[model samples]
Target: MAFDGTCVACLVHELKEQLLNGRIAKIAQPETDELLLTIKSTSGQKRLCISASASLPLIYLTDSNKPSPMTAPNFCMLLRKHISNGRIVDIYQPKLERIIHFTIEHLDELGDLCKKDLIVEIMGKHSNIIFCNENGMIIDSIKHVSAQMSSVREVLPGRDYFVPDTMEKSDPLSVSESDFIELLIKRNMTLAKSLYTSFTGVSPVAAEEICTLSGIDSYLSPKELSGDTFKHLYNQFTIYFSAVKEGRFSPAIYYDGKEPKEFSALPLTHFGGYTRKEFSSISEVLETYYASKNTITRIRQKSADLRHIVQTALDRNKKKYDLQLKQLKDTENRDKYKVYGELLHTYGYNLEPGAKKLEALNYYTNEMITIPLDHTKTPQENAQRYFDKYNKQKRTFEALSKLIQETQDDITYLESISNALDIALTEDDLAEIKEELINAGYMRRKFTKKKIKIKNKPLHYISSDGFHMYVGKNNLQNDELTFHFAVGNDWWFHAKGTPGSHVVVKTEGQELPDRTFEEAGRLAAYYSKARGSEKVEIDYIEKKHVKKPNGGKPGFVVYYTNYSLMIDSDISQIQELS
Candidate 1:
């Protein structure tokens, strides 16, 4: 679920309990769209982060502090001057909308206690943190929205502050069953759309959950539902809303395998097949889910250039490979042409001049065959022409075979680089990959005189059996780990016939346990493109037997003798060395 009205309501409930009488101690604007407020309550000091980022609008309690600028912004200064020491009189959500109103009691210039409302709206692009008087007139906002910016409402100072009721949605907590059924019937859209359009703060995920709970197809229109079905659906809505009203919030994140799919302020029974991880507070759930999501998002953003380069090259090479394969197939008849020339020379010694055709016996197949000849040339001349044609095609076949092999190698190298980017967690990892691309001639080197000093290293993990296993993140690391770092007795592991990391288990002149071997194989599979597979085939060989061919691509190796194993790609239980 999104950080919808229900999520905000949960946060409001938590805030009302934890920070009802808290006094504002400090305030700061660390980013253009974010505000950090420190409040001193009866328990202790607490940090509340309010962000109105157009991409990710969020509000949550955090323990971390962001560094503020040397000079404060005008809005931050205004907040400090007006409500730096204001007591939080009340905190509430408005009709299940994605908005929170914090009513603060503050002392005015005349020493009289006055009330003010600091509103935080969590709408996507229209999100804002606004300061207003008790009369609901906006004093200022973190983001100034003028008449030109929005036709719905203006968030500038002196503007009337109100929750823009553009949707005209009813409060789900108070709506009757008949009204719910009627609202659904009024909408011609799907059942999911009707649920969100008819009620405030119910996201598509929540709507889908309602439909799933009621045993109705979310894609089906409300007009298709029977009266009994509508009643059952409304009953499910009441039960879901009752949990919200009764404060039975279960902050949880649903995971598809190892990746977080979605999070909700309440238990999502519809996500039964997915892994559900519940936290004690909604803040924790939001923080954990977003932190993981942000890390993955940032890595993808950083690796976009690398991915584009690899994918473009891969496509070109694959096309070239296909064309080369066709040319090679065309040359498959070169052997037949050679046999034709030989048979024609033997069978046409006494033929008439410019013989158009000849009958010959195929010595290999022991069968009679017909050979066509050029009418303008003599029998011997026609045989020589056939030989020349055969030689040309034979040369083509040889050249194309090598070209095809090289093209395949190019595709494999790019794919390995792509797989490396998937596991690249730091800028150092990306730097190493970029350097490898430069060295491999995929990317041109800049005109800088100084050489790059690489700081990235292989991932080191201690197996369950206490054997040290190292996994390379990219081709450069793979070469370094296998050739320079590992000893002759050390074991090397790789995903069989695929682009993957080179994994090395340090034997220390001692034999490795079965569990260590399995762990190392798992690492090889997890870092490869086959990470999502149920089981990946891995080949393991001693470092002495695994040899890199001269003039071959980086991380490319040949091992005639090796042990193979099928292992799953889960390495979560393996402990890594810092």
Candidate 2:
């Protein structure tokens, strides 16, 4: 998680094995702080990406290539001039620090072999890629840091290159058992903090891992630890670093449920109960972990406005719906008013002129009732006034009932769109939703300059029984998939009484296996608003039985008869097709 000195140690070990003696074939700078190097090694051609970005510094071997700028940056040109055809003599890490030094032997402009050091520092804010001569004098850097920007050290050309020791942390590889104990006992910090602060490369997570290995509480004060506890901690710490020295790295990513929590270059026994995905290389681990994280981050950024739009509309509709319900409730007295009018109409002839109130027997309830009246108006006029109130309330109830239903429909539509946004994995998926929103009049159509043809399609899956299943991503896809893509014999599934994707399993002119039907139901439930619920009720029927209403909203359908199943919304076993 820290991407600290230990990770750098692992990377250097890997680079030394894969890239040592490799000839630099080509170098390209695809971004302001990124470089892609193509190298010819004894094994094969390898592409190495190194980034000095302040936000997300990374170094990994990748098979994919990035598009370079039309004009190379000065740093890119400089590296090309110096090390274009250089041979990598050695790759090493300095004192277990978060830095990598690549020693390159190349011919200078004078046609004489010269050596240069290409240093990549992966420190958080102070990260940089620097090229220096054999004398350790900086030639140039990807990012120029001066005394003005940082009082700690300057990274300008011709400055003597050296790793900063501002933190005064001891190198873990050199710290003796006695030194480690003395250092921790003297510190007033917590156990976790003392480890990270006193030793290089020990992150908080790594510190906690040591505690777990020693069977000790990380919150306990180091000074308060007993003699046996101290010995256990030291033993565990030594064992952990011993693997790094011997290159016994077991790269893996820890997961909390389905979410990636952290990755390490060594086994994280502290995460024994959690899910662990082991990788062959740390580069593979970083690439897989970050790529998934980046996709989610990018999609969230792209769908932020859509989420806001949907949520706002949802709130408005809910308010309107509640107000309508209240108005509908107000009409409850309409029947009483009607009864009063009827009683007055029948008993009006017995009423005295100028009476303030009328006392009459309510025949319906068989009870005496007192009804207020207008003294100046005749009994007939009073009865007519009561009749008008009844009529107005009755009319209000009818209109409100219809409006309430419409408002509820709008709320449901918005929730479905929000769920679609959550399921969206690509920009194309978002485009489909945006189009749906624009068509629904919930958002103004933008005057976009670039017209990316919408090719968003339904998610296709193969059930455990080998039946092809199609799940709609949004309402538009749902309608098209059910009405056009599916055949009459195909089985359809949906989450009962909830907004969800329509799932259709192609029967292939044969009866569907029970397992296929269950998988389709699971897909329907997983893609719907009821996802993750203990048991989601799913309705399944033949495609022919699911009829779309005339002039209905997208994906709205009617079905009088359908089989139902309560099942978990787990589709991890289903095979997905691109």
Candidate 3:
């Protein structure tokens, strides 16, 4: 499914059909690697996307538009000067190599009708977009290739332009059976490996497709086939080769269950249809899946110290609260202890002057504390000291009890905030969570200037069945997605025990389906740190049950009555926005 030679061929065919006789209406560069050209034809208007990026070079008809920069790049301005209102003359592919050329006829500043060429080369690591004049003299390139970039070609202004030779490459559409067998044996590799590695135009997916058509194991060694077996294999190969010549192609995204494996052999998709190019590459799949993994890693690192602090505070608070409660309960017997000590001191005088024998008394305070008596001391002096000791102990208990309660409340507050952060889905949600820390005196508040406004949109995915699923990337977006966009009956999903994006499946009043549930699980898992794990637990429920708590951190919510399932976080299963 990667942007293979076949995709380049498709681009040539499309441009020939739509842009060859059309007039260029507008041009813009949406990204560094890409260009968008709006053309007007007798049929209607068409926008063509062209890219010469090493990683994702592509050319296709696209309906989606992007915001253009205020000032056009010099290259863009130059293209507009020479090619604006130009009529495309022809679309040509240089043999079967990864290059396409669009020749345009237009008037120059002197009003002479002249020819110009736009060449897009999509060879990985050597990809470039070159503009040349009528005589094939290089004008400039999107990327200037010098001796340092590539010795094979130098793309600079005023340089002569020519296509490089690729003699070792075999065109699968034109190869004879004898030539194929000889090449296969010469490569000394497996059939699939030879087909994939020896050819300049074929993708691994295409190699696999050829093997599938041949009814042979792609992994089988080239030397393993017998003469008769080779004959049968050649016959099958010829059939597929004829199909290629006839332009019989089917485009389907291959998947291992819920994950996208590749995209090729297609019933062609047009603009506004599912954009296979978005998930056509294995690298794209890896990037999306691992981005969520890195997010989880960052969250764990950020919260590690905070988690420990909360745990220690909680333990100390619990211990102090328990001790304080016990001390306060002892207050019931405080007066009793004081009365007993006083009675002993007062009654000592009656027993004998300066006598030490303690006598029992009816203590008004409930439980009693025994008092030590001295034979030499007067009763009044002992009684006075006893009262003072009782008052001091009582006051200390009251103060400790109030302080302990305050500590318990602080622990409770911190614990709640920690729980909210543990479920934060995006960096914006983390920002709101950190604000809580600042207000609670755990973080310092610097007089930071407010940030400039930028619109944040939800990450959107279109399901295989054509349902639109929206994932909120931050708490604000989550709130908007769930409370604003989601209907009561729409399904909501999130990763269990992990902070993740809110995934909403817009049911549009349709009954819930199993595939939809699985797709939602993939979204939930892919948006969480658990995305890289082989499997993750996902919780799902109706949108109605998901409630944003009052005064809670962004992306924080409480929901009950949900079901859970285990799923692999592989986004290779879901279709991403192009």
In terms of TM-score, the best-performing candidate is 2
For residues 400-457, what per-residue lDDT tens digits would candidate 3 score against the true structure?
7778767665655555555545655455556665655665566777774865244446
Worst 10 residues of 3 by lDDT: 266-275
RMSD of each: 7.0, 5.8, 11.7
Off by over 4 Å in 2: 1-4, 12-59, 65-169, 187-197, 204-263, 267-280
**Candidate lDDT (C-alpha), each:** 0.89, 0.89, 0.72
For each candidate, give its TM-score against the true structure: 0.70, 0.76, 0.57
What does the lDDT come to for candidate 3? 0.72
Candidate 2 per-residue lDDT over residues 502-529, each given as its tens digit: 9999999998878988899899999999
Q: List the residue pairs that clash in candidate 1.
A: none
Q: Supply candidate 1's per-residue lDDT for 181.
A: 87
TM-score rank order: 2, 1, 3
Worst 10 residues of 1 by lDDT: 292-301
Identify the runs in model 3 with alpha carbons over 4 angstroms from their true place: 165-167, 176-178, 224-238, 254-260, 266-472, 478-498, 501-526, 532-578
